[model samples]
Target chain A: MADAAAAPNADQYEEQHVHEVYEQIASHFSSTRYQAWPIVKSFMQELEPGTIGLDVGCGNGKYLAVNKDVFIVGSDRSSNLVKIAAQHEPHSAIIADSLVLPHQPGRFDFAICIAVIHHLSTPQRRQEAVKVILECLRDDGRALIYVWALEQKNSRRGWDEGDDQDVMVPWVLKTGKKNPMEDGATEKTFQRYYHLYRSGELEADVNAVGGGVVDSGYEKDNWWAICCKSESFTKASG
Target chain B: MKVLTLNFLTCAVKACKSTSTSFPLHPKDCEMVSDTIEPNPKLLYNILPRVNWTALLTTVAELGFPELPPNPPTIEELQADEKMTQELHTLLLETQISEGCLVCGNCGHAYAIKEGIANFLLPNHLV
Candidate 1:
């Protein structure tokens, strides 16, 4: 039964659905045809050694391989992805929600919610999910959120944009269950794209929530921002 | 009778528990004042969607702190108070009621949180 406070439109990616998505995405990774590995490598370079990290929506554990020294816990809405992640990176992986994490508070030093926020249909849900992630972190913990910023004015949907765009694709409710491997099983329906962040919006949101942006920029066709919880925000006010 | 009171009581109890501090209210208090106080109006804004405000307020007032904000707070008032931020953080992020009760603001349903737990169990009425 759905709780009264739970968002009606949000879909919980249970273990089964997650597995199917990962199994399909895994095959693509195995082919070595995509440039995803290098991007994951660059992301790993910025981490502190032995940091407890969470890879929210981590697909297939490709990034895990590069950060073997860090205690990385990979979570995905899709069970298929969780399975693949566990199989590939046995040291770290779990099936969990991006919006409502099952772990205890302050469990991690860093969290990476990459390539997931845009999939949500509404900004309210996205913000709530972000708030949940913030709660999951310790006072000094950090997060790296990579989202689909706006595409260049004349460029295609996936085209790389040097600057963030305001437009975001909308969510299209699927009429029926989608078969992961079948072509045209799911359609790419576009909703109004969210206005991509101007350079300071990421920092501003983090600041409002008592956090600070450590690093932010676009790379390899996606907008990436890293933020850390500010100690001053947690101090009891006089 | 109102659920918001119970929610506030539960929240206050949980908040007390989080910091390992004991509140003045007790279980016996839960039964005594359950009938007297009106739900805090500020609770509507503070507890909506996240808290079972009606139940919490009822329970706490029953336990004794009957002076909960009895009305929805103004935007200006909410912004001016730091306590609101702290309270909201605890109410939304800290309190985890597993079996006591879930009182909805919109529908005014007093869902049970049985056995020291607040059940968010949805009944068949919603389909």
Candidate 2:
């Protein structure tokens, strides 16, 4: 039997629900007073003048208000968030999916994916989303991505307790724990979070896809990674 | 007059050979030009798997070319429109730098292609 959170179409429902929640949050937090302002400001200070930038999974247009001079486009999957962004920053916001941006290749100088990767149900989806975003950048463009850390303090509870065969969330089988929701339920009902990098893992992943980590740091619960396309890596692969 | 003519001819030959071997500008400039004329489309098609159609069309238009065939090109049109076909083929296959700059439609990053090379280096903080 399917768990409540793992119904026949649970993935679809979860995706929609996440977007709906974001919409509600965006409406209330459209102002600069929101917490994302400082992060955005820090991110913007490093940018060169007249540089093109993108705000991926940009929930609202708050960050855009401060950096109107730079060419900036804010995109989100949620129609409501996109509407809010358009209202706040007309002609600069787009309704688009992060996993498949509707833009030309090498179109952006920089891309910022903020506080959205962990929310993805699986790591494969998260990686795929990164690939799609990378495609939108020029050969030497940079990407600033923020994802939930898999560190000890940041790791969520109830993550590892499912069938060993399941690859989506292997943490669920850490100790042969049973599914919390129902008996004989093959589907796990835990909120998933990726484990912290075990030295070189992050860099390896980035290098594997022709990217190099230019900078990395952490703020509170979020781990930030700044990466640039490796021209040599790409050239060699080509 | 015969001696003078011979001297002039010899000087012309030397000048031609010297100019062919060495550029008037810096050696680096010559290198830049050589690198600029990169592998054309025929050599590049096998390496590049994906091409952004919209960007290709926009670039061709910016270069004073005609608009692209609609999303999907018709066989009849492909057969009849040689220019369109050639443009499409070049856009799809060519690896040469056709333009000097690219403006991001979203973020407006002005990527300058100096000497046929695009510099996409971002500051440490922006990365």
What is candidate 1's lDDT per residue for A135-196, written digit by digit as tens?
Answer: 66766677788776554454465543464343334333343454432555554332332335
**DockQ (Cα-based) per candidate?**
0.02, 0.01
Predicted model with the maximum lDDT: 1
Docking class of 1: incorrect
Q: Indicate the worst ten consecutive residues by lDDT in candidate 2 chain A.
A: A165-174
Which parts of model 2 are misplaced by more than 4 Å? A1-13, A29-33, A37-40, A87-91, A152-205, A231-238, B1-127
Candidate 2: CAPRI quality band: incorrect
Q: Residue A209 deviation, candidate 1, in Å?
A: 3.2
Any idea how many clashes model 1 has? 57
